[model samples]
Target: MRHDLRPGRLVAGLALILTAVVYFGDAGDAWQSPWWVAFPLVGGGLVVAGVVGVIARSARRRPESTPPADRNRAT
Candidate 1:
């Protein structure tokens, strides 16, 4: 099986999982954090993911330079 790894999706999924964990912890009274923290976390995660995706796309679109072949080679 072949699989492709997407950095943006990975980051976004991690962010969502973290947010859920935070909420779960709060609900279970394990620890307490500002309720607004999740907003920033999720927002920042998405922004970072977007930037990463843009960079990856640009990198993929860039042309790769190959070495020039020798001109004096015998046929």
Candidate 2:
């Protein structure tokens, strides 16, 4: 699959990575007794954002529909 890094995608990825690092690092343990909770929440949010970005991009790129009469008309 071709890799296209849109701005939204990049931001999502960054958010995911940041959260992962925090969740795995000592800071996460200090912030919360359990790391699992924060990890999953942040990771899931990032995934959702990424998916939304992809869907938004796809919708933006979709071609507009034309009526049957317009399709038959000459340029």
Candidate 1, residue 65: the lDDT equals: 56
lDDT, candidate 2, 1-75, per-residue tens: 776557666667777776766766656465554646666767777777778788879876635586677766764
Worst 10 residues of 1 by lDDT: 66-75
Q: What's the distance in Å from true for residue 6, model 2?
A: 1.4
Query: What's model 2's TM-score?
Result: 0.42
Per-model TM-score versus the true fold: 0.73, 0.42
Poorest stretch of ten by lDDT in candidate 2: 26-35
lDDT of 2 at 34: 60
Name the best candidate (by lDDT): 1
> How big is the positional error of residue 72 in model 2, measured in Å on the Cα after superposition?
21
Cα RMSD for candidate 1?
7.8
